[model samples]
Target: MDPLNNMLTILDAEMGAPSRIEKTGSWAVRFDEYQQFRIGAVLRGDIWLRVDGGAPRRLSEGDCYLLGDGKPHVIGSDLTAPASDGDAETAETGGLETARSAAADPAAISSVVLTGSLGLDQATEPLLRSRIPGYVEMKSSSYRSQVARPILELLSRENAWEIPDADLMRLHLSRILLIQLVRTALRTADGCAAAPPDRLLTRMDERIRCALDLIHRQPSKRWTVANLAAAAHMSRSVFAARFRTAVGMPPLEYLEMWRIRSAAAVLQSTDRTVSSVAAQFGYSADSTFSRAFKRVTGRAPKQYRQLAA
Candidate 1:
């Protein structure tokens, strides 16, 4: 098994998904619902992050911060500090005034803030949660430093106003930053693996990745234990056992999850009927699809589509 090829396949699938972006006053932020890994790039000014009981951490210009779990955290300017019950107007006015004044500063230039929540899906959540710290900061330098600078500029530019394709541009730039962040996070100081040592892949790990790719690339195809084992070049017993150990679930269970995820994409992005999506994913009947979808997502296809829409 080629370890490099397997790693590349995993990364390629992770990077192919779309990321989301929003503009709030002076801040332009991008995030994904997947929430496996969380990242935030601060382009201009400073952001004060208020975690439940911890003191606020200040994120300055050109800084990138990552939060491994999608832990509940609040980020804003200094005005985000603890306030009285009726100090809403005071905080709002203060934040707006500060952001406005900062934008007016010719020296302020432009800054970008990028944040992402990183996780390896539900299967790997426990491993990541136990291994990674609450947050890790990478001081951008050399090539990474150069690459991040422009992303910050773009974010700052978009936050100025509703420019043409501004949101689209921010989303694209955020995606690039995300890829770079993940790459950096995967390689260690000594060039060894940066992902948890215990989580590092073995020979069998490569095969599991291959099997996962097969499921992701063709979720609509009928997949059985025997067929998947053959695809991974392993015997049924060995493949099933090793796959569960490496990927944290039985092969068929992972396939069902991927199928629901695929159907979700269609339901959210396309006008296709639920029955059409059900058939697209090889379900014999819409009821089966709905039951499976509800099992995975906790909402029926129709309700999920409506809420997503």
Candidate 2:
């Protein structure tokens, strides 16, 4: 599998069903900092989006954005407009919620935005945080528009009609949209970067990906920074520096995290004893394994298993 797909699988990311946000006249909504990844598309009219006190940018019809930084942001017809809490304007419509301007006039509705979140687990949050920018904008004029436009159109159509399995269809389409957006973002310049892209993981460096794939595919294997660098065809010092810059952590540290996290999953799901599970993931001693597990999970194997059971 590709690196992004592999990381998604490990993270157990779930793309939630989409919601429609309709607004009229001068309206702005503030979305507080959130933990789950967020995606939004302007399906009609134009809106302004600002993240974490950053300058607002205009998003025309068909434009979309993905949020990875978990920072507070605002979206509206006008950035200078008085804002309302996004949560307060939410109302259920046909099993899905719709957000509207504080003083909404249905007849004068000017903007329709499609938004959703991708739920992920703690184990792989760092992988996303380190690789993806806090915010990314995919413009309608960009090369990715060919893929994004049709998907957004379909989502808009699905939201409007009452069809068979409509909820399921929207859910699936939203997932595809998010996946495509991330895939494109990895290949293109990250919008959040101040200068021309100079980061390692933001642009999907193939060499770094190769080293990451090896560690992810075989976390149980004994790994060292030097070996990982060698696999990536770089000298030890260069590889270590690059790996840290790309992943926000050293190679061996990442391997340990993956190993402990994978072992935690096994401990929770299977009947295997602590030592066997530890050994399966390359832990040589029960005491050592227990210490590592505790450090990561705040609980030892037996305690964790019992709680899970």
Candidate 3:
């Protein structure tokens, strides 16, 4: 499987669903510095967004943004707009109690903006999050509009009509929209520095691709810098340097981050004991894993599991 797809699948597993948000013209909302990731898609009109202490930017229609990574941000028609014009009217469907709509006009919904929280790996701090900026954006014009536009349009159509399995269709389409959003984010220049047009997974040399594949396929394996280097057919030193240059981290360092992430997925999805979880991922002892997890995630495995629970 593609390494990037492998990593994204893990993220979705942890953040099983989205908390939908919808708004319209000149509306604004403020979100606290979050521990997890927040993603938003503007379906209509435009949005003026500003991360804390960051300059504001205009997000036009058909834009997808990674609002922030554990940073507070404000979204509105302008930076100075009130945090919230008023409470939002929420609707439910398919037994999922989400769908946020800002009813500024009782007559009609002026605009539609959908936002979802990637509620996963809050404790472990997934590796991809660090490589990406606190606030990154992907505008649809960068790629074919057909990719996300159709999916979202289908959602809009299904939502406005009372048709068979409309709720189920919307739910599935929303998830697809989010996946396309992230996939496009990885390709857009404005989305991430590490993911320039020819960077990310597109321009990976064969060696680097092989190494990444190995790591993703079996993160539980006892993978050392030398092992990855051998897989990449490079000396340990050369492989380490190249991996760092391309991926923004030394090979083993990235591996540790991946291990912690894999452990986190297991912890959130299953009822395994902390020791068992650590051992399953090749950590020699629970204490060793706990210390390492703390250094990276700011919490022990047990504590992280409890909080997630």
Give the TM-score ranking, best first. 2, 3, 1
lDDT of 3 by residue, 190-255 (tens): 444435332336555679868987887787799989888988899999988888777667788777
Residue 277 in model 2: shift from native, Å? 13
Q: Alpha carbon lDDT of residue 290, candidate 3?
A: 92
In order, the Cα lDDT scores of the candidates are: 0.56, 0.73, 0.64
User: Could you tell me every candidate's TM-score relative to the true structure?
Assistant: 0.50, 0.61, 0.52
Q: What are the per-model numbers of colliding residue pairs? A: 19, 0, 0
Q: Whole-model lDDT, candidate 1?
A: 0.56
Instruction: Say which prediction, candidate 1 or candidate 2, comes out ahead on TM-score.
Output: 2
Clashing pairs in 3: none
Best candidate, TM-score-wise?
A: 2
**lDDT by residue for model 2 (63-182), tens:** 878888888889999878888877445424312457766577877889998776666555566667666677777887766655766675576567667897766676566566666666
Worst 10 residues of 1 by lDDT: 12-21
lDDT of 1 by residue, 241-284 (tens): 98877666788887787677667767888898888889888798
- The clash tally of candidate 2 reads 0
